[model samples]
Target: MIQKSIFYTSILLIVVFISSGFKPYDNQIDKWFDLDNTDEALYIFPSQKNTDYTYLNAPFKGKFFVGYKEAIGFKESQNKYRKVNTLGYMGKYQFGAETLKSIGISDSLHFLNNPRLQEKAFVTLLSRNKFILQDYINKYEGKVISNIKITESGILAAAHLGGAGSVIKFFKSNGERRVKDEYGTSVRSYLKEFAGYETKNIPAIKNAKI
Candidate 1:
């Protein structure tokens, strides 16, 4: 009786393993290559997509951009806008260096110029009980973090290292401004793939220890 039970259990385990096959736990490569019909392709592959969402997402999520234009006459111009956006996820936080690079962002951009974005993301993650930026800070051994200013245009952020030379300027304008917004478009795309990967592969990788 014992031998028969052992054989049945072994067969069941073999069947389960064979059915599962080789599922990708971290399919960042696959997700990167598969460009969807959303703004994520643009932000992640700006060169390939030749797109910028800095304007669109800025307003709803409260973002603005500061720029200057030449005056047609003998008058000065003064206008400034900030772009804002928000993205939500339903699972674990799993962003990293390779993923950032795959999306056309480098360590300099991720670690340096994107502090505000990261912090806001961290806050959002905390709200959802998904992950914590403190975990990254702990793992990375105390990286620099800067406090950001919040306004109607959203949260202003910068890194001490790469953002040193960056500046925001105001200009006066005599006419109304009209332009299309596409900043938050990519937020949807990013969330889709990000959530998909988190839901699909994260468990397998976590459970591989046994």
Candidate 2:
């Protein structure tokens, strides 16, 4: 009788422990199981933290691989030399027909087919943006807006994404004037991601060649 009574007590204790969310040390399972990755906890956790913007606050130094014009190209079209998006933005740098025409690329088919032309077009656009936003870059570079330290490369990248006018507005408003493309990519995002790079080689020209 005592044995049976002890067994019932033990079972009751186990049930109570489980109901109270208690588990033995050996029985503890990972709380992160099957949880969506976008969870705040995942973002805050040290082990799982994203390092995408770790260099945002770092000193102005160039990065390799996806740096300079190539980074912009990758962001636009994943560096696909022969690709064209649904919006008709063509080639590796995803230049619209109008933008291409402005840079002296009249034939969209020829521009899309020629990888060299695409590269030149990117440089030409960058040069043009540099000229247009030179004052803003000089004024805002090294200044922090919305916790992000502005850099020349960052300003240039933002200009590439949302035009020189949009970049000027973004900085002038202290990041209050939010500008995002159809892909929901914001100027701030580009500024943070592409903060440090060497673009001084590309001269600011009134009419850069494509």
Best by lDDT: 2
Cα deviation of 169 in candidate 2 (Å)? 1.4
Query: What lDDT score belongs to each candidate, Candidate 1 first?
Result: 0.25, 0.78
Clash count of each predicted structure: 26, 0
Query: What would the per-residue lDDT of candidate 1 be over residues 1-210, giving only the tens digit for each residue?
Result: 999999999999999999899664541322343356653332232333324334332212111121101110001111111212132111112224433333334443343345454433323322222121223213322221122121211101111101101111100111111111132222112212112111111111211111
Q: Which candidate is the best by TM-score?
A: 2
Which segments of model 2 are wrong by more than 4 Å?
1-66
lDDT score for residue 149 of model 1: 22
The sequence of per-residue lDDT tens digits that candidate 2 reaches over residues 1-210 is 999999999999999988889643452234555447654332222333355336443223247423566666667776788998888888987888877777788999888888887887888888988899888888888889998999888888888787788898887788998899777889999999888777767688876765
